[model samples]
Target: MTELMRTTSATLSRLWTGSARHLTDDELTAVATGETVAQRTLAHLDQCQRCASSLVHAADAIDLLQEEASASFDKAYTTERHQAQRRRIGRRLATLVGTESPGKVIHFPFSGRPLPQLSARSGHWIAVASAASLVIGVSAGQLLHFHAAPAKPISSDGVAVTESAQTVPLTFDMTGTVKLPLLGDGLQHPAGEWSSLTLEEFDELMGNPAFFGNDDLALTNFLMSEFGSIDALTPHVSDLPVNIQ
Candidate 1:
């Protein structure tokens, strides 16, 4: 370190001289020892402002170096400080644990377990799926109940309840007309009026004089003659009786 300082001193001296030529060894020694120098060297130094400024800067730098050296923390001081800190920490730890200071770091044995985390989007999908499943289950149950229900019996003439909540039966074809019996036989219903007692109400309706007049007698004769003709042609079971008179 002293060698480096000497080298810097020389370079600064040359800059102050304003020339590359170095100072004589005697002149350098005189300056170092603070002895009176030659009249020529003294005159030179007096005339050189650069050399004067350089010397003043060098003096300030030396003073800063002395202060730093005085303030330095040595290895022994550092070790002692660290040891004091450790003791203080241990005392605090001991107070907390109600135990003597172990003078060393303690190792814990806690196990590290990982659990699954659900993000906002994943949680939304799960909720949606659960709701959908519930709806599907309810719909399936309703469908099964509908399939297992018994058929409702149809009442012949009274208001009838049907699958579509209508009085009429549901049918695909609408092209043909249906014929229903509105008359009744004598045993089941009186000949003059409509009755619930008859299985054949259409026959009783046709026998009524208010509705049929003489047309029923003419229809009976026509039916008998047509049967006679059909029987003569087929030569089948005994001929239809001819008692139309």
Candidate 2:
């Protein structure tokens, strides 16, 4: 009997110093299930002031007992509250863990169309072709403008000469044609004549004696004033005849 009392006292002392202050959820469950570890722990707790105080706060009306009883009213009430709380938490955890979505399939609404789709390579080729056509059209217009001549000739010997100048009809093959009533005259020159001048020729002409002064300083200042900066002039210089390199 003395040994039993000493063993029970030592166990209670250990519980009071160790896990009694803050019992884990597992420990509380173990206590609910009447496990030997939990029973021994409770026996120690009954004798311990700190465990007894904590127990009062944990379950106010439940009678602390060293031996198991068959469904005591206080114990049943305490167990029911704890089990309800655990079940609520368990249900929440299950809802969180069980939520999963199905895989999705994406559909394009306007995949099929009359317009041809262009790849990167096709786009690049188109840009190159457009640039080439622009260059060619400009070159042809400039050629016509620089070579334009008067219909009649005035000779040095003061002779009246009847000369008919040969004219080549300009024809453009385009996707669509719209004839403007005012501009539909057959003798009108095609547009974009000055567009044929290369970057080098443009720069040289801009700096020529006929335009700005032929001095480098005057040309640089004029270009900077017109274009905002010297860097802006570099791209146009490459288009000029003298600065093609």
Candidate 3:
């Protein structure tokens, strides 16, 4: 312990300029097994409270492991077991020194190969196409507006008046040809006296009066020929034959 303190003081005297660093596994192992180590390791162990605490913890854990191992094994195998454990610990310490931590390598966009650029000719063509499309759209809009139907005039009541409400006098000439007239609102100027005639008078006018004369005999014959007999139509009780039994 006195020699350890002297070595530690000598290390501190040599490297007392800056902050002390943490001890590596090899340095810690050397300290634990009483092997010669760098003076800086000893100096750091003396100055750094965290490293000193870690060394103490490691020593306690090793002692606990040895105690547990001795309890499981016989006294005859004690020396061999201790030697083997030390050898294993040394090999592990050496591996820890040689091993390096993996690092992350990030690759950002545009960090490697350059991006392909658009050519001047392609850009000019794209602009020309865009301008043509704009002009075509404008012309189409104007053409649609020109072809649209005009709006009907609106009245004072906020309703659209498609045609005039007042009636228009319609006239047609039928000087040389015959014209048939009808009653009611449609014809204001009737050509013939057909509207003034009653239904009976119209029927009389349309009938062939010269062929079937105005006398009642001709009418009776016509009626009898069309219908069966006047007796059957009139159904007089006097015409019925009496059966006197």
Candidate 4:
């Protein structure tokens, strides 16, 4: 009977030592929040001063976190803040649409008839037809205005002259394919031969009188039109600085 009593006491001592271990942080948190924890953890917290102090700290931390969360939630969901945000959005939208004032409504006159809607295929075909028509129009214009090469005239020196010294057209025609040469066939003769010519021949050699007169008139008109007068375009002696020696 004494040996059996000693064996029972040893088993009880082993169980007590195992259950007396310190509580974990999770167990302490569960206990602080009133969540169901192991009975051994509760018993340990009641006796162990260190575990009790840790549990108090954990409970205080949880309370602080809960208070902060509640304050943040209340501030975020306040009616006044939401209303102010809505007012700002409305003002921005009003400014974007050029109203510059909130609560202003714009109404358009609606026709009784529904607007015509084109299908994707129909729209594509219309675009294609427009592009084809443009291409055909341009091609036709080029073909109609196409010109053959001008016949070259042979000069007295047997050199083929491509152009004649003639008065330029009053109105420039861009549609024409032919361009008049800037230096005409008049340069075919040597410079020495010009001095030997008669006054009548020299006059003929210097192109038409209309070409020179037209150039002078064009220059004068351009200066007057651009500057309001030739005096404004060309600086006078009085307008120049007197720094020169």
**Per-residue C-alpha lDDT of model 2 across residues 29-92, encoded as one tens digit per residue:** 4555556565546755666676556555545333434234545656777977989999777777
Which is the leading candidate under lDDT?
A: 4
Alpha carbon lDDT of each predicted model? 0.52, 0.50, 0.57, 0.59
lDDT of 4 at 118: 85
lDDT of 3 by residue, 1-245 (tens): 99999999977865574345567788788887768977767777888898889789888888999998888776567788889999778777776887643344688976788877789988999999999999999999999998897554443432333332212122234232222233233478543233333445434544745523343233334545544333223322112121121
TM-scores, one per candidate: 0.22, 0.25, 0.26, 0.40
- How far in Å is the alpha carbon of 75 misplaced in model 1? 14
Indicate the residue-level lDDT of 205 in model 4: 40
Candidate 4 accuracy as TM-score:
0.40
Better of 2 and 4 by TM-score: 4
In each prediction, how many residue pairs overlap at the backbone (N, C-alpha, C within less than 3 A)? Answer: 10, 9, 0, 0
RMSD of each: 23.6, 21.1, 27.8, 18.4
Name model 4 segments beyond 4 Å from true. Answer: 1-17, 79-139, 147-160, 164-245
List clashing residue pairs in candidate 4.
Answer: none
**Candidate 1 residue runs with Cα over 4 Å from true position:** 1-49, 72-163, 166-168, 171-245
Worst 10 residues of 3 by lDDT: 236-245
Candidate 3, residue 81: lDDT: 86
